[model samples]
Target: MAGSLRYRLQPIRKTKMYRYDQYDHLIVKERVAQYRDQVRRRLADELTEEEFLPLRLQNGLYMQRHAYMLRIAVPYGMLSSPQVRMFAHIARKYDRGYGHLTTRQNIQFNWINLEQSPDILAELATVEMHAIQTSGNCIRNTTSDELAGVAADEIIDPRPYAEMIREWSTFHPEFAFLPRKFKIAISGAEQDRAATAVHDIGLHVVKNAEGEVGFRVLVGGGMGRTPIIGSVIREFLPWQHALTYLEAILRVYNQHGRRDNKYKARIKILVKALSAEEFARQVEAEWLDIKDGPATLTAEELQRIAQYFTPPPYETLPATDAGFEGQKTDNKGFANWLKRNVKAHKVSGYAAVILSVKKTGVPPGDITAAQLDFVADLADQYSFGEVRVTHEQNLVLADVKISELFTVWQAVKAQGLATPNIGLLTDIICCPGGDFCSLANAKSIPIAQAIAEKFDNLDFQHDIGDIELNISGCINACGHHHVGNIGILGVDKDGSEWYQVSIGGAQGNNTSIGKIIGPSFSAQQMPVVIERLLNVYVQQRTEEELFIDTVQRLGIAPFKEFVYASPIPTGYTHGEDACVY
Candidate 1:
């Protein structure tokens, strides 16, 4: 994969998202104005809490522990440099000085003053971004592989299709009020970085036997009190039929999904109520009417959307760059960053660099205003003026030249983003937990910090290799606890916060739900328990076998025995409200 390097001058697209037409702009403007009036009414005591709750939620405003929180959609996780700067401005002005990235690749601004929310939405509209469809019982932000367009193993760039769906789902009248919230995730790559298997609908883009592009669609997957991996409802659906088929599935769920029990309202429960086979049969029957209707895609429409996502002008260069290789050889730190943060790109000599927001001692996925503004400038200079948010809670520079990686690493290191811990144990995916989330059963950030501190040695983390540690403050599984190789769920017993540990879980093409290791442990005991489990993995594992692979081979029995057999459980306090170690 080597050749002579040549300069290729190309123009960068000013935008990566679906270009908003007059209709799109008008719709958003109308919604914002309506919400502004609604807020005024509520403030004037003309509206009650019951009257205003749904209105605020649909606009992505949530009343959290501290104040109103705003969730902004990063459509398909794509952001331009200008949009990034807007986020920085909003963070500094409307709320705190930082924003938290979510597992769904959305951004949450905490401490937002309720009165200023309309203004925030107004600002977002100018950037072709919004808070609509990000909350409530409708289609949430349609998540996809963070490396949607450029991943080496991608079948087709999924962003175009994701944008199509985004357009269809936005303000969809029929789905505005469903039984419960619904999420959809798409994966274009051979590997499933989007964690699609745990969403309400998981869409895997595939090429069929005849080389026609299509989707292998999964349904009934969800995480919460009952975590269920999705079942493939369609082995292969032609690209044109995606919308119609989706409509059928949603229509069936909307009609028959349990509304009496909000607990069982998710489509997953419906799939369980009737078998997956039955569910598929029903969907097929329902799809017959709508299959070739107005909703069916035209090739021209697809091309129009795809035109927005064309690759930027890439240089004709050898796969291996001398400067990149030299830096890797000359500096141990630079070598580590390359191995961890940098990922292979489909285009030769271009690599995707992940800027880890999960630095040691910081809350996972949290980034300050200044840091985001810095990233915005870096994107303009180094990454074709674009950025992407990853489901793993990190930011990605999707198109950095291999030759420039060392220089980029130096700058990134200065900003403390050059953490050589990508895909490692300490690069944790975590939710806000009890610290900021009223829904959390216990705090998650401190536990993540403790584990990261205990294993801060990069050499040890690299040796451990590619372990995913995900933590959720409660069963809502906002942090995707059910899908991590090592999953930590915060549990409340009586009144005290106790942590439950699970192993063997994973999120990918081979997704699985983890099994619990027995009773819960206190916060102080969590990191120690984790260390002991890692010790078991080290002692029992064959060389280079990933932790999840080893767990699958040996089962949780051995790890469970090591943690519980220790004296900590015996010495631990058992009071209803004690925080005893």
Candidate 2:
């Protein structure tokens, strides 16, 4: 209690966010104490490196290429201003002066010291945060849309359901160890902003014709060594049975999933090997046993969880703000930011704003301690002290008033957080790659930077239109290259880094994996290869067609031809399997 963190500042008004209860506090505090002892024993040479590896991993501490990495979970991407300030504190005091926001809706301190991990956890505990289940063979963070409660197109607020799943999965005895790591994503919006299709378990909130709410469940979809889109196992699962149904699926996976090979251990492989129909049948049989068990959610229980996600208090105002429109009309930069970064909100006078972390030179999701602190200040002033971390590695102020758009834009621009390229080609989703991760085959950040530099012009990026370009340093697909409109995968060929290019991949309602254009390219050739692919798209695209639309219409044939049309530049050979001209 002596070192407990106290909130010295508060938001102007009450906002919807999950608050910690006594049980949550007890669990986190106990885990911290246990982990502290584990660290002590390891330091005293009682536990070997091999013995401490899994223990540290379970607490979200990884020994990376350079140093120990501490991953702190931000459940469903929700972050209070106070929590963010604590992140800044950790970044400044424990790790480097910056922290990286990961695609899993978690934050990572890549330069952490092994001995300071328990201290870091202790600091996070004060803010009601932890790193549990962030690693190891278990269910990782349950992510959802950043604009969950505020999205205009939302069917239902997904935070409650996501929170419920988080509660059920955390420290479950049966799932303490699984065949491999599992990921789950839920989206209630008509547009699948959460990229649920490529998760182990994808839950889409839907309403039946009878006006009953339920989930459309998809299983076994993931992007990794073997990228496959998930198949829908259930058309409609009643909300009450969500947990029981999830338990059934996990049980089926736990029993049948492969253990001999780590590569083949994910539920996706099992679902694919057994076929979706067979897997569905197995899950259904398992579900029947616990159909109406104690896990069944009641109306009262739903309300209790749902109340935490209720919309914040809002003042009555017209949908359009005249002054905001006039400012946008006068300033081209502000207009572009408004068009690209701002999204419609459920409330008439409110909007959801994406603060771009994809600045041209910066790593895709890296934010400095100063920026984090500034964002906390901004959140307190403009967005009710709440910020959301997007799965695409951006931050969001979910409840900004429409009239305050210009002020928010100005403040964020001064902080280098306003890049005005949310959905553009330059707005890339990239992994830390060989720069940090021991598993990475190549450096992903440089490739992203190369592409961003080549296409540095804002006008050019805007002209090219909305495109999702994802880069992964390895086949692990942490950057989710398999689902990008244009996917770039870093590979090792003959002990050198090469990139494999894919096109036509997409997330959302019509999720599909990208097709390999032809062969892998050298790191130097990645930018050129992307340019050629874009050239094909620009030349062949019909009126107003997006890059993905053009790829779908023309297929990979045209793009492939253009990429390989020219002779291989001197001194460079495609991989061993490539057809060298």
Candidate 3:
């Protein structure tokens, strides 16, 4: 261990850790042992790569171009300070000192050795966390609104339902060997922060007219080769019948979902082929048998689960703190941070603060281990020792006091997390494109970086206000490009990276897929095209108009003309002269 050579040859160390309960510890220990055995068998050539693929993927291990990548699930995007510290520790110890927060609300550490994966999983389990079901055909992490428990608009905290789904789906016997991976998201608030509409199954917890709590279920929304908005299968499914109804939906899909063609295998395709009405009828028919059966949730069981997610005792504090007002009046930066990052919390004194990971010239959602530790400390100090990961790939301090806003802003700014660009043009949602993903047709991170760099001015971003610029590596739409106000899809044109642009997409209540404006642009021309598109909106829009609203009114024609009329030379043509910059 004295010399560098000796250090390099040192055996990897496994550390024992603590958890809240015996079941948590026991499960993690068993899982580690199981995975270690799996790894040993694979290395010994007993398990073929094909056989080992699903096993590894289930444990959140991916064999990438250079090495293994491990995705750690942040269940419902909720994390304690200690859990986050453990994440930082793992990132620093096992892999590079950085982690990527994925759109699915998980953190992925690249450069993990195959040998070290079991140890990592062991470490994660100590914090009541694991990589299980992070990937593969079984239900993935049951995501919910990031501000689930704390949001003022919330009818009910969706975390309890999410956790129920998580447990039920963990080792679901029948649905485990499905045709493709399934994703489900739940939201309880009026504002659909969970992007439930775009998920395989979107559950919206609501109170029906009869004063009964139930879910308005939407099924078949996905963003792979064919992106489709989920269709509403049930306008109102009784709370007690949640599981039985879901089982019915899954059973129908498993039986009839396409298995012949991988591209056409998603539930979305099935829904389309059968039509939403027919699919709904089939699911209803299947549910009739299972309704009021063992799968039906009892009030006691629901209450028992709800107990775990009960809100922490929050003291009544003043709505406006003098200190916060003074700081905002004194410091312009603090005021800007308050304006952009802080969201209203249900409690009087508390505010939800969005930590923008979208810094200029950096890949969005990429945070260093040191930064993770810094955020964990901030969460402990200012917030209530909790952090939430947003679907848009941002971190949120869900319970910061108004009195501590300035202090929180200072700490965040020091760590480069206070970009004051949340929901702005610079805050791009992008995927790990050609750099890491084998499926990508073109590079997405670079395009995101380029846009961020191009629109560095905070004032300019503010003027361009609330624009969602989403980029995908391919048509698979991992970055949710289809729902962005301005969408960019990467395409391969004779081997070069070309980007197709779309406009008028929105993911909120008025959700719609973006319409393609015209022919694709070279990577170099994308920024210019986006700029021109924005310029057209700025020139033509009425006061306080958003990007989508402008596009909806003018249609894609104006934007298309502006984009293609002066196409950049060396970029694809729409049969028009290149516009002079």
Question: What would the TM-scores of all predictions be?
Answer: 0.95, 0.95, 0.94
The C-alpha local distance difference test score for the whole of candidate 2 amounts to: 0.90
Worst-scoring 10-residue span by lDDT in model 3? 1-10
Model 1 off-target regions past 4 Å?
1-15, 569-581
Write the residue-wise lDDT of candidate 2 on 138-217 in tens digits.
Answer: 98999999999889999989898898888888888788789999999999999998888899999999999998999999
lDDT (Cα, tens digit) per residue for candidate 3, span 1-581 = 11110101122222111123454456567878999999999989999999999899989998766678899988788888888998899889998888888889999987899888888988787778888878887778878898888899988888867867776776677888788888999999989888888888999988988888899999999876787899998999988888888889999999998789879988999999999999999999999998877677777777666666666656789998777788899998888888898898988988999999998877999998899999998877777678889889999998888888888888889889999999998889998888888778999998898777766888777877898989999888989999999999999999889999988888867778899898888887776787788878888889999888999998999888877785365542342332222
Instruction: List the candidate 2 regions with Cα displacement exceeding 4 Å.
Output: 1-15, 568-581
Per TM-score, what order, best first? 2, 1, 3
Best by lDDT: 2
Indicate whether candidate 1 or candidate 3 has the larger lDDT: 1
Per-model C-alpha lDDT, please? 0.88, 0.90, 0.83
The deviation in Å at residue 373 for candidate 3 is 0.8
**Candidate 1 global lDDT:** 0.88
TM-score computed on alpha carbons, candidate 2 = 0.95
Model 1's TM-score against the true structure: 0.95
